[model samples]
Target chain A: MPHIDRRIGFMGSGQMAEALAKGLINRGVVTPNQICCTDPVQARKDLFRSFGASSYDTTLEVVHNADVLFVAVKPQYVGAVLTEARPHLTPRHVVVSIAAGITVDMLLDAAGPEAHVVRVMPNTPCLVGETAAAMCVGGKATPEDAELVSTLFSAVGRIYQLDEKLLAAVTGLSGSGPAFVFLMIEALADGGVRAGLPRDVAQALAAQTVLGSAKMVLETGKHPGALKDMVTSPGGTTIAGVHELEMGGVRAAFMSAVVAATNRANELSRMG
Target chain B: MPHIDRRIGFMGSGQMAEALAKGLINRGVVTPNQICCTDPVQARKDLFRSFGASSYDTTLEVVHNADVLFVAVKPQYVGAVLTEARPHLTPRHVVVSIAAGITVDMLLDAAGPEAHVVRVMPNTPCLVGETAAAMCVGGKATPEDAELVSTLFSAVGRIYQLDEKLLAAVTGLSGSGPAFVFLMIEALADGGVRAGLPRDVAQALAAQTVLGSAKMVLETGKHPGALKDMVTSPGGTTIAGVHELEMGGVRAAFMSAVVAATNRANELSRMG
Candidate 1:
């Protein structure tokens, strides 16, 4: 468990920050009163205030108030925000950044060389409490800082501690992968509609099937191929569908999507 | 909630029957003592016995003992099992069949015309308590029987009441869809590994990404395309990946898989 008394802060009160704050409070990891945030937009600050958390207009106030600060600004704004709070950076502060293309070295450069930093790549599903997130610690970060970040992230979804080099793959697989799945679900519903089901019924069933299938994979800890075999009987409809998917080259399509996304992430990081 | 005291029985103690029984007991819909099963295999009967449910060797005994009977035999054996229990079935009995490709007309024919029947198409995720099921009632079934069936199936996962004509589509979408999704998840993991992630980490993220994305679709009541747009930024990783999926004909592939599966299901039903 993370420290209940720790004051958590967000340098930017964006959607991702709001999601983390909501998850942390909902999971009883911290109280609403223990959360603070900074955002330039008045409406965004009001959104945090509506949730019973304190919100501010500048990064320095959040830095002064919080022990663990999340850098949740857009990638372009990350360096500016961290540098604004650099003077207040202390050994007590653990800075965690969720900016998409920003690396730990960049955060360390902006927040000062002695500052503790952790870089995380989280998907949009954090809003729905099922995020797949990965994190890696900077040189200045302690093991306790890594544990705290892991605990905080696990409240939203499953989190993995991995080498920083793997974060781009995480960005590809869990980050961009959601869009690929959304497309697949829509296509599946279209198939059902074509097969005589009502549109709404098809959509609901399509989404639920994806949810259930993913749960089976996670809970069984069985190789997905083994799980697929469990559902496919000899000469059954499942095998027929699987055959069509194979003939259509669905596997290669998904593989290519991930590879493209990872390459793009690498490109974006280099540009950042 | 369905009647707590109503006795439930499985006409055949197969994997599907066990899953429903476990779901019912776990959800507090029924007690183990309220459940009964009949199986020719001593091992299967013993498995039910081990779970504190009464098991018998004869369908007649189960029919006489239980008010709500699940016709869980294989498609080929449904006729023989229902015929054997025909004399024992009464007006109080509600026959719910999960036999794939076996129609209500066939069940009614085997159990006698006055019999109440409901046909359901449930996927393999029922074993994990995340089933996507659809059911339709026969002419002899009452509204109360339909409600009871809905309640029972909902305990395992989401259930829809639809016309019998659309069941082939349901079978294609939710029934056979899991295997397709499994193959996609595996491919996504492979892509992640190709991008430099460890295999275990890649697999976990891939599955969680699917689960979370599906949850966003179900929980937000938003169109999947809109959700995809939420994650996609201009010239970003998600759109890059989506572009690859589009170029690879991923959507058409999924749509064709469902259509192919539906056609196979229709063929199997005709043969049955």
Candidate 2:
């Protein structure tokens, strides 16, 4: 495979597509004009245009023009979109699918036997330049093809490469982890509001607290239990909270949530 | 009263005291030697020496030498430490207590009738450049006293002023919130490990995902739920994880945890 200047296209102009485009452009990985997207919906097309990226009405145009095509449609529609766009794809074109629960095998089948395919699971933070994504290659995708896809994801945030089999677990963890965290922050903030703090003050406190504590774990590299012990004294308030969480089965609940999502992803793969 | 350069003392030689001392010295708010601390433990004295600050053998020496004293002792010994140091305190000195669950009333009473006091609850992230701290002033503290204490905390991280009644809730939320988040990240990383990703790779993804998503919430000012919906389509994998959380009562459990901590803080205040 020869190294070529990166030309990327989005088969769908949804939030994920726009976020990746925004991240790539902001990081100087690709220019606004160099990236192209197509969406049947007028609002989505207009939204993409506002970011100064080129937008098309049909998937054929994007597949015909770009070197790397990101199939960003929903998981259920991935088959239809890939089948429709496959004839325009050649061996030189690297196809990456961002639809969750859709496996690399299904994507490769839809894009034809000769097409190089990479499967990616990226979370919501990519829109704001803080995405955690995992990418894996299958079929005709060479090392060069994998590197190209990795570069695109890395421009937005951290990227990891794993066997395609574990991408669903990544889907369960990072891909859906943000929502679980958001809910946690909301519940904490609501506690503050109920305790008589003003809404904005409460929200800021709740959010910044989460932000700061997370940075602690990254910077210190200490065990979470040690840090928890630092904050908690014998018979102190924090221990009270921990006791409640334990009693309420918070940890088991989160674990089960991730497992459930992973099982669902596997089911989707089998269905496809 | 004339404005004088205040000499501040930290009574414990630990991460929190060192972090605050460094922050104050970095900002020229106080000098290394101008701040005094005491830890009966030799290891803690060495840690203070590493920061180029003076460490004392007894709490009385620290209280006698400094105009503003931070009682950074652990929660269990706050009473004993304050009792030992109280006789040396003068009306000119201010006592700032960072021991969580130790009330301002208890601190003032322990330090005697003339001592001006304040209570603060801060999380461990203060070691970095970010911390969420909530503070409340004692009956004797003036606005100027409050401002000075606020300035000291600001050097370490953000500081918020609230009624003393709400301090326990702040303790429940941010002061303990980090541990809850750390558990979530650990569980998520464990899921990745179970799915065949390397431990280090899984840890990095889990940690970075948290960092980025938190940045999004802080920067965007959008409702977390709204941001969540933006990432999730009608039947996507994110919604699948969300469904499990809903099923397992994640929101309710976390909310109850905060309330439990608040109640415990209130109980601690009455423990004498």
Candidate 3:
């Protein structure tokens, strides 16, 4: 379990911050009162207040109250928020950033050189408590800080610790990958409708099929190819479908998509 | 909960039958002693015995003992097994067949006209307790029989009651869909590997991304297209990846795969 007494704060009380707070409280990792946040939006602040956490209008108050501070603002606003909180940031604070394209160096520059920093890429599915997240610690971060971040993230979903260099690949795969899957599910439901199933039934089955198949891969510890083969009998419908996917170059399409996304992440990071 | 007092029996103790039995036992839908089975393979019978269920040598014995009789034999052997147990099957018996392409009429022909019958199409993910299943009640089946079958299947995963004409579409979407999604997960992982992620890390992340995205659609009760749009931002990595997928015709490929699979299912059903 994470340190329940630790005061966790968010620099921006956005949807992502709200998800993390919900996970922490729901999982009993921390008491609701142990969390605090700052957001300019009145409605967002009220949302945090509904979670039994204090919400403020200033970064300084969150920095003062929080032991672990999350820089949860938008990518463009990350620098400004961290810089505003830099003066009050101390060794007691471990600053974690969920902002896309924000590097550890940028965070350290804005948060002061001595501050501990961790950069994480989490997907939108965090709202459903099924996030796929990955994190890398900065030069100033201790092993304890990494552990704390890992514990907090595991509450919502699976989390991996990787090198900073691989964070772009993580962005391409788990981060942007959810959108790709959503497209696939929609397409599958469309196919079902095309095949004469009612739209609602088709959509429900399409999503459930994706969910179950993914569970097979994760739970069975079998190779996806092996699992596919297990279900594909000779002259069967699965094989027929697989043949169509291959003929249409589905694999190449997915490969190109992931690579393109990774390239875009690289471009954004460079521009940042 | 399913009727815990009702006895369930499998005519053939194959992997699917084992999965269903395990699900019923694990979910407290039924006690192990309420289950019985017969298999030609000694190992399979022993496996059922390990679950504290009775293992019989003859299908007649299972038919006599169980109120709910699962026609779990392979498609090729279903006729022979059902015919052998036909005399024992009474109005009390709800004969549920999970053999692909075997229609409710075929089950009625072999099990006797008076026997309540259901034709179900369930995928291999039943092994992981996340099965996607659909069923259509036969002419002799009562509403009570349909409810009982639904209760039994709900223990394993989601179940839908649909018209018999739509079973082929169900076979295409949920039945063959898992293999398609498995192939996608493998391709996604391969893409991650191409983009510089470790193989294990890439595979785990890819599978989790699929699972999380699917959960978002199911739990949020939102259209997958809407959810996809929610995550995409202007000039972002997700949109970049999605653009590549579109350019490569990923959606059309999926639609074609599901349609082709549905056509194959129709052909197989006709042949049967």
Task: Flag regions of model 3 displaced more than 4 Å.
Answer: A1-3, B1-3
- What is the model-wide C-alpha lDDT for candidate 3? 0.92
Encode model 2's per-residue lDDT on B66-94: one tens digit a residue: 88988888777888888888888777788
Off by over 4 Å in 2: A1-8, A25-67, A76-93, A190-203, B1-11, B21-69, B75-95, B109-117, B139-158, B189-217, B224-236
Indicate the residue-level lDDT of B76 in model 1: 92
Note the DockQ of each predicted structure: 0.87, 0.48, 0.86
Candidate lDDT values, in order: 0.92, 0.80, 0.92
Residue A22's lDDT in candidate 3:
95
lDDT of 2 by residue, A1-272 (tens): 22237788999888888888888888788778888889989998888888888888888999887889999987789999999988888888999998877777788789888889998888888987878899999888999999888888887887888888888888877887788778777877887776566777677777877778777777888765676777777787778778877877777777776776777777776876
Retained native contacts per candidate, as fractions?
Answer: 0.87, 0.59, 0.85
Fnat computed for model 3: 0.85
Q: Give the poorly placed runs of model 1, Cα more than 4 Å off.
A: A1-3, B1-3
Question: Which DockQ value does candidate 1 get?
Answer: 0.87
TM per candidate: 0.97, 0.79, 0.97
Residue clash pairs of candidate 3: none
